[model samples]
Target: MSKSLKAICAVAATTLLLGISAANAGKYNLGRKALPEEIKAWNTDVRPDGQGLPKGQGKVSDGETIYNEQCAACHGDFGEGKDRWPVLVGGKDTLKSDDPVKTIGSYWPYTSTIFDYVRRSMPFGNAQSLSANETYALTAYLLYMNEIIDDEKFVLSDKNFTSVRLPNEKNFTKDVRPDTPTQAQQKPCMKNCKTEVKITGRARVLDVTPDAKKE
Candidate 1:
């Protein structure tokens, strides 16, 4: 393509992206306001307290089928994870060890997060494809695989989602950081934080594997 043609194409692409941005942002005056349904499509986050959880239920058996067909490609048959994909189960007593295996059963604090994440951004490429029931079923299946729940027929739903808590639930504390921008977690650490300040630096590359006794 000629330079002028390429420039024209680039301008067109930029205009298109800006138009889209303006449409979604709802700030600029050029694009029309987003419809209520359109806004709702993006507002699908479920809170930790099951606030936004949709009414749906699924059994572990159903979850197993879905996992085998839709999830096992990357997360493995038993949530052991394949390649660099995240491991989803086990790691019960390894938190205090040299390497902490943070998985659904091991490190995640809430069951609602399981449901929310699965429904919102799971199954890899085909995100937001799973329904509420499917997500619930997968959550139940993961719970079964993690040995948190033994019954394969156990059903998970929004009604009892808050009741189901992970082993490390008590470990995760609420973020008390200030809402305003102060450049600190809560407040600026100006005084001596440690008894004796020691400058130590660690490499960024850390091979933290998700592994534990499956039996």
Candidate 2:
């Protein structure tokens, strides 16, 4: 056979084998394996150690401008937050109060999370629209507003992302508590759950039932 014919036959065989395998595997032939690009698109998570930060840079000043244009309406001018919206600034020492003001500065543990979250989802209706630099700037701006960063000229980038930390970072420690396993893992008594169910109490005697006479 010709080289092209062999290639075509190989492809056809591979496809047929895959179809047969999938068909015999299970009752539900669902979604295919995720593509590398698809996984990469959703796998834009930046860790606390700044592992997955993209290559970009933004100054706090730039962040402020972007915030005002996109984030201010809901987040307020100074990140005070508008009506029913969450406050992103202040609440530095209100954590112990009866109503703790858990803003980004006071509550979030990692700075990288701020960048990651904003990049993944922000601008309310427009998520994942911010470029890497825009995300960096926004993060830098938030840091400044929260008093985490000292300068508006401070430029934020993936390289220096981990240097900045949230106030709550020191408060967060590794959870040493044991994990609770699901009840589904336990062996259930499917047969003869109980010897018998007896109604030992009378509802009428307990005055739980309505009176027979009309009120």
Candidate 3:
């Protein structure tokens, strides 16, 4: 019956009510679980191990045909690229250059990535329109253009997908962040961070920012 006891009881009731509301937050029958078919439709991503590759086959010759028809407008006839579009083929040994040409041949780490990318999004405006066979053929053509595959008659499919590997595949190393030493582990330099500070460059002289007032 005391004022403090009444206040304490009211506070306890409010806390209990809030706990109950929080427990039943998402219990409303708003949305149903996605069907298997619905999930399959969106889960079209292919993996490095050729897990999601559909049952289909294609040759380099067939890929050239598909590439010319579907891909040549944006990417050139031989994947040289049109205007400022991405160049798909050639760029061997250019990774260390001042302006490196990162084509499928020189830079791509895996062959599966090429197939997956082309299958999912390619031909510029028209995306995801290629069949499994078309994707395989295009992938083959790109490999041939890159000189990875000697025989144009070579057929690429889910069976032999892993056999074809990119040249730069060996260059790529696994992320060693977990085992590698980090800067945080080193002793921090709180005082005298540097012996002397020098002006390396001037921002005004660099002219990195555009003269917006001129417009």
Candidate 4:
């Protein structure tokens, strides 16, 4: 190549390398370090104990309007899930089924989870679309549809929120295991010490004849 051509190429390469380095330099840095207020702004998660939930009120009746405008397209008009989207109502007795049809009232353990889940991720493609009051109304409507709360009941604001009880609330339990090892599981290893691992058997194939398998 000519001397001029080589010089131009070297300059171009240096400029490209510098641009890449500058673009990625911030990626490796500690990252501007989020301010305390900024952190608080994004971390608006509400706990099951009714902590961090904003001050707002929403009734099932009000929720109906919001649902039809924003949610009915994906989550059926009656909260019945569309084409395997996710059903939000019914399933009162299917928690123990082989293919359990779980809903907020049937499997969820607390009402706060509904608020937290909806606030963080919901409306399918558009997340964080609803405000605190809207989320409250939607949650209340879902509860009403699941038969856990009355349609006229209001669920919002911290005062009334904590009082709301989910249907599957009785399914939860506290972990009572001791910090250290307990007598029930810590027996001294003696006889069948399992010196080495061994593969005993393999599953049998039903109809495959070692060829022409469905991929």
Candidate 5:
């Protein structure tokens, strides 16, 4: 038999043994898996500079409504934080203070980080439950709460989002901690390294304690 005929017969035998019908067998060409470029098309994420933001509109009032229905229970009505959950407003100059408030405006570096974080994870029980417009509105509401912007509307489109600067934009710096191998290898010692600990000042000094000390 010819080499071509032998190869065709071998394939046919294999297909028959595997119970694959002629109509189904030999109907496809083997190809490589999807490329990174193909996968990235669906994985859109906005960056601090509004790199991947989509076009959408949202108002602070609209966000208030959404927050009431979906987020208020956990995040509080005004983003003041519920129970032990984190607050989403204010903070500002507290970054340099001892007891920093660490709110959205005071601690967050990028406005886009808010949208990106919420898009990726938020609403606690049902993450990614909010639409782009809803996310924008919620972001605007948080901004209002932080006094970054007055109670105005904010629609987080690529064009508008990049314009929103965070109040604590300078609070955090890029990781400048030495990346040198020696530094990375060194473990910080916790005990008795300093010759003396001085009480230069108190952070929160009270006139008197709630309970008086024994005489």
Candidate 6:
């Protein structure tokens, strides 16, 4: 074959191969675009600013009733927690203690988080079962139990959801990794960098771990 003709044939072959590969890539139509209702159902997450909260109102008194019926089995009647379950109230100054008890009143940074979590995953096995109004009621009841709000008749709705703020909200700052020195820039020592090695303490001597050899 002529040199120019051979070069043209090679180029044509390469183009054909690339076209075949592109056609075969991800050829299987495994999934389709989600339906509007499906998208709405899965996109039920409420944001910290109450952006996705559903339109509904619930009173603290109503929440207490719903909580006692649906939630008291796991969480106590007043959000004190049952057995090894989570305690949702109190724990005011325990954050600095050795055994810090983090609770909804002391640890959570937003009221929306409380509403969102409970609305999505509460009542133990049955999740996403509470109506919008019921979730708001439960949120209000929790706030009242934590002494954040005093009124039993206080209605919680999307209109004023952002009005209630958690005490720890001020403690949480935005992630500033872009503005701060990275681990590589922090001069992390990877090799024998320490001048001297001293045994501060032994776990066996401190009885921190059980002596399995003694058995």
Over 4 Å off in model 3, which ranges? Answer: 1-31, 174-215
The runs of at least 3 residues in candidate 5 whose Cα sits more than 4 Å from the true structure, single-residue gaps closed, are 1-32, 35-42, 151-154, 176-215
Ranking 3 against 4 by TM-score, winner: 3
- lDDT of each residue in 1-215, candidate 1, tens digit only: 99999999999999999979966775555657768999788878888888888889999999999999999999888788899889897788999999888998999988878888888788889999998899989999999999888977799887888878788888977788776687755877778866876658633334344663333
Look at candidate 6 and give me any clashing residue pairs.
none
The true-versus-predicted C-alpha distance at residue 163 of model 1, in Å, is 1.5
Once fitted onto the true fold, the runs of candidate 2 whose alpha carbons sit more than 4 angstroms away are 1-31, 173-215
lDDT of 6 by residue, 1-215 (tens): 99999999999999998877665655673455578999888888899877899999999999999988998888887677899999988899998999787888899988988888998888889989999999999999999999889987799989999999888888777787676566765778789989899999865665546554532
Lowest lDDT sum, 10 consecutive residues, model 2, at 206-215
Give per-residue CA lDDT, model 5, range 145-169, as digits (tens). 7777774654445567777797667
For all predicted structures, in order, the TM-scores are 0.65, 0.67, 0.70, 0.64, 0.64, 0.70
Identify the runs in model 6 with alpha carbons over 4 angstroms from their true place: 1-31, 174-215
Candidate 3 global Cα RMSD: 10.3
Give me the candidate number with maximum lDDT: 2
Better of 2 and 4 by lDDT: 2
Model 3, range 6-48, lDDT digits (tens) per residue? 9999999999988776665666734556789998888878888
Error of 1 at 49 (Å): 0.7
Clashing pairs in 1: none
Report lDDT (Cα) of residue 133, candidate 1. 91
lDDT at position 178, candidate 5: 65
Give candidate 1's whole-model lDDT.
0.85
Give per-residue CA lDDT, model 4, range 41-78, as digits (tens).
Answer: 89889898988898888888878888888788887998
Q: What is the C-alpha lDDT of each candidate?
A: 0.85, 0.88, 0.86, 0.81, 0.76, 0.87
